[model samples]
Target: MSIFNLIVALGAVTHKDSDHERVLIKRIKAGDNKALEELYELYKSLLFGMIISIVKKREEAEDVLQEVFMRIWEKAHTFDENRGNVYSWIVTLTRNKAIDRIRSKGYKTQEKASTSVDEPEFSLEGDKFDPLETTIFSDRAELVKKALEEIPEKQREVIKVAYFGGMTQSEISEHLDIPLGTVKTRTRQGLIKLKNILEDHISRNG
Candidate 1:
């Protein structure tokens, strides 16, 4: 083939690729898996590169890359045509998800490392469980911790005295030197707040 003809053929190939990609995006948004596969072929390497940059491990980045695509596929109808093109959108999602996974896992690791090795020095249930039970209990414990953290400090202290220490409200008032009405109000509000937090947790977990 003549060099000039070869150059023209290459340009035609490039234009065909770009045109096919545009059609693939439109069809993928319409829930066509074939089009999604074409879109995946066009953009997978780009997506993987962005993920690997953030997550820094080939396996983890690859897993996150798949997650990003699954989200895109599941949510394609939600994508707005006015919001730039599909390639750019997929790249952004891939980077964001990979970074989020990396940060989340890193934070958990750091928290476990920083926590004391000692036990709580008291028996709630001895902290032993099968894997499934431990997962459920851990989730509940986290929810409880988050709920307690939302309470105002003084009310939380008052609650600790009444519940954990087995003191009556009147005893709590006497011990804390607060008015009985104030103690009761704090307890009431604290429990209401705790209930709200627990309801939110159930909704999320369920």
Candidate 2:
């Protein structure tokens, strides 16, 4: 299905009955491949959107989605409904897996060396700001924007350059004419603050 259709499918599943989800999980734990397929049909789009939001590459997201389902299949028996609903569990699983991919040594090495010699500087070109334009998943883009608004201005700016702009710390420092240490500090502090804010938001809304 197209990405747009996938997002709509995700929205449809979001409000589905929790008991039905729980039953599906139970069946999955019992080695029912058909139940697994049913679960995948319901959650694949939602999880795919989430993976894309973090990785920003369709191919990588697709690979990660397969890995995520594989993990779900292997670990289904470990899920505890008493602690949280199935949907939240799946979301946490997907986010953690995506973040793991982002932080992987191979990914870091690739990201650091990926910059082309003739690459142009990342710029806004004075265009109007739009959160949806920042990410494939509009809901995640909004959450990120809201979290950014709660951070200090300097930290927020550095993070945007480092992450959304796909610039390394040194590149960000040189581009902004700031000290490398300062750039690193802001990136670190900004991420910690953003994580706390997002965690709180999720807790309140979960």
Candidate 3:
């Protein structure tokens, strides 16, 4: 799916998967491949989007995604639903695997080679502001996008650059010609405002 459609899909998925997820995991533990397929269908977008953010390449993210499910299949018996839900467990596993991939010698070497060439800077308003890449919950992306519009322009700009633009605070400082401290301050303030705005939006809508 296009990123736009993906964001819509993420938002449309209500937080009602707990019971269904538990059943899927139970079946998976019992060696049901169909259950595993059902689980994959449910979470692939969120997982793959997160992997892309970390690994920075669609192909590598796809490979990492397959590896993640394989591990899940092998480790299904170890899952403890009482401690946490399946979504949390799978997301944690995917993140760790993606982090490991980036930390590997081969991946490091490849990343260096990939970044050796200069690349053009992208505008946040242009094509790169994918909501899925941000730290916000994927399942609330559309709401978060609307809530973002309600924040002060300055705060919203910094938050968007930090998250969607994939830039560090220092990078944002240099790019925006602002102090590093200012960048940090804006990001923190922006996130706090965003949380409040998002919560209010959710409450009102529900």
Taking every candidate in turn, the Cα RMSD to the unseen true structure, in Å, is 22.5, 9.3, 7.1
Query: For each candidate, what TM-score against the reference?
Result: 0.42, 0.56, 0.65
lDDT of 3 at 197: 71
Candidate 1 Cα lDDT to native: 0.58
- Candidate 1 at residue 121, lDDT? 23
Which predicted model would earn the best TM-score?
Answer: 3
Q: What lDDT does each candidate get? A: 0.58, 0.68, 0.70
Residue 44, candidate 3: Cα error in Å is 2.2
Which of 2 and 3 is ahead in lDDT? 3
| lDDT (Cα, tens digit) per residue for candidate 2, span 1-206 | 22222222333334444687899999999999898899999877657656665666566678899999899999999999886667656766776688688778987786788673222222123434342333323455466677788999999888766543446778889989999999988877877887777668667887
The 10-residue segment of model 3 with minimum total lDDT is: 117-126
Q: Model 1 over residues 40-107: C-alpha lDDT tens digits?
A: 77666545544554444556657887888788788787777565555445645664676477558673
lDDT (Cα, tens digit) per residue for candidate 3, span 27-73:
99999999999999987866777767667776777899999999999
Clash count of each predicted structure: 0, 0, 0
